[model samples]
Target: MKKWALFLLMFLLFILLACNDEETNEHVSSDQEEHEKPEVRTTPSESSKPKTKPLPEMTWEHLVNQEEGKLTANLDVDEKMSDQLVETLEKEITALTDETNDPEQIYRGAVDLLASSYYQTYFEKASTYDPDFEEPYLPDPEIEKKEGKKASPKKAFILLDASSSMLLRVNGKIKMDIAKNAVQRFGEVIGQDSDLSLLVYGHLGSESSEDKQLSCEGIEEVYEMSPYDEETFQASLNSFESKGWTPLAGAIKEAANMSRDFTEDVTVYVVSDGVETCGGDPVAAAEAFTKDSKERKVHIIGFHVDETAENELKKVSDAGNGTYYPADNEEELQDTIQKRWLPSLADLAWAHTKAPGPWEVLGKLEELEKHTNKLTEVRQLETERLNTVYRLIRDHDLLSSEAREDLKALLDERDDEIRTLIKNLTDEKKEDINKQADDIKNRVSEWRDRMYELRDEERDHS
Candidate 1:
């Protein structure tokens, strides 16, 4: 019995020993498996890489240079993250390029971008404001060479009628307010080369002083055409409010001094709702003004006016040797002024009427008119085509598969009509352009003849 007990104890001890050994080996293997792969200590300096190229210093010349490589460099922006930044950069560049001659303005404009939406977020997070954050200035673009160099700055009188009629509401805002907004928008589009004057009529009360009345007349106490700076112009626009009658003729006559400046062509833009309150023929006044000087041309735009007003406005345009624009609404008014008037005026300014310069001012005017006609025709065709498609699509019944197919056929037909219209319009424009080219050639020949005649006269005098 003693031998049996001793043997059993020895067997149990051996089994326990084997089990303990196995547990120790398993723990060691598990630990080895957990730490077998290499440990990675990723520091930010190694992981967050820097860009290969440094950001370029913003300069006017660098930004505006149309050269492919230079443009690419200036435009090589991180489009995904920096659309606003890109816009800001472009605006700064344009503003700088435009106002290069004004050193103080250039300085202000350069830093203005830092205050823009793009940079504001970064700036707000900054601990301090840097007073010395000035961008390096660059010289202007080489003034483009021309046959006749004329850089005349034009003065334009914008006589906006802020009458009671304009006070009527449209599109969730008063018409006068909308007009005010539109004018403000136009101010933004106007070139640095021109000076603009803001005069609002019908805002004066009945018992107002002579000074106030004169101020509104485009003459009397007139706010003369001056440089387009934000503060003064914006103040004038903001202060304008509707009050009195539409004195259309008196306004034109008041601006007649503008006609006297033969050196610079004066343009008058009369923005009105088109009812003559103190009835004197505005057209007659315009005719008289043009006849007297033959230098000034007045443009009349009827802003959301009645049919009678439009007809009268057209007459005034004819009398003034100008174009009548019926800006039926705010959007049309905006488009008319920016896309047509401002650019035309800017080009005229480059003619420099100050001296007997060789700039083809008349030719430019004609070209502008032609461009307007072409654009108008194109727009009309496009609008007509769109309307036709819209009508067809909206009215077409598609209950059955056959009806659906029929509607599709109609859409195809409209598409064909649109294509035909486009082709016809394009061809017409081409022919018109060719005719204009021939006319220009003739005019050049005539001008050459006149020049030769003058030379002959000079020779005889000598």
Candidate 2:
């Protein structure tokens, strides 16, 4: 019985040893599995990571819409945003160029972009000034006619600058030649019955400091203040050469002296290529000249002058309470003379009513007329730009089929916009002009009645 009990204890001890070895093997296997695995470490899932949103695809339509929004905004005249707007356009154009290697497409895009910028600038410039549309006071119409002769004939003094700058070539033609031709045309238009005079400066000497003295003293009334004579005017125009320093102030001073003696109203048209070169104060001279004479005005014409020169020249006109017209070429010069200068002459003539009140009213009407003319000229320029764009697209192979179609559509829209703006401006100007004309008519009728009352008062006193 003792041997059998010892055998059972030995068997249980063996079983216990086997169980311990198995447990040790399981621990080793677990360590090996951990080492063989990917360290049992955690990593972000694909769904857990942040994703980038794609950019919206750029297109021509999108760019057009953006520009349209910018242009349609109520912008001030002095807003300095053209540069930024141009930059945005350039970026869009660059993107378009990257997608298409077509030169035609690129060219059309560039031109259209340029046109858009130009029109915006022009529109802002035009809106800078408000038109003067106030009506003047009127007198009574039922008075008897005054027992006096009609008012003296109106006079126009053409102050032609024969400075050396006028000798410069514009459009392959001499500036002086263009100026002389314009003056001749003006003489013809004014006719023999009109009182026209020519006062030329810088016509006596060559362009030199030695000649400066003679040039400064060179102002000569070539044609006296008399009825227009074709032969006399032609001879006067032929008498001078474009030479020497500008004596603009001296010429104006001389003109003021001449105007002081005249019974009728005087309009001085100073056609110059530059400002006062002889150390003269033209603005002061102009102001002094127009101070006492209610009917006297000084108008300036800048022939082919740069911006600096234009600003300087504008001061003379501003001081004189007159308008400044800039001419860059022969065509522009002619337009300035005919549209601006000649019309002013006509208005002055009309203002020569015997009554003072009617004359003042007539002056206001003349101002309105000049403003309307300027707006008309701007509209014509826009029309020309529109026509030029159309011509380029229709007559040239400067655009691909797809580009041409898109550009045409865009231009058509632009054309419509410009046309609408021009029409609106025109209608407004016309309405103002009509109102001015009606006011003038009423004033003239009232002036006649006032004259009758004055004559009756005089007879009763006598």
- Report, for every candidate in turn, its global Cα lDDT versus the true structure: 0.54, 0.65
The C-alpha stretches of model 2 lying farther than 4 A from their native spots are 1-153, 191-193, 339-462
Q: What CA RMSD would candidate 1 show?
A: 25.5
lDDT of 2 at 46: 61
Which 10-residue window in model 1 sums to the lowest lDDT? 132-141
lDDT of 1 by residue, 70-171 (tens): 222232222221455445445445555443322223233333332112122222222121122111111111222222423323766777886567778767
* C-alpha TM-score for every candidate: 0.39, 0.41
Model 2 C-alpha lDDT per residue in residues 1-462, reported as the tens digit of each score: 999999999999999999999999999999998888875545457697455444223332322333422331433322333555545654555565555434435444444443332334443434433334333222221211232322222778889999888889998889998889888766654443359889999888888888889988989999887787778889999988988889899999999888777877777888888988889999999999889876777889999998998999999998887779999997777766542121233433453252335455466556544554553554344334434444454455444667666655655655465456555654665566466656665676565555556556757989
Candidate 1 error regions (>4 Å): 1-153, 206-223, 258-262, 293-295, 339-462
Q: How does candidate 1 fare on TM-score?
A: 0.39
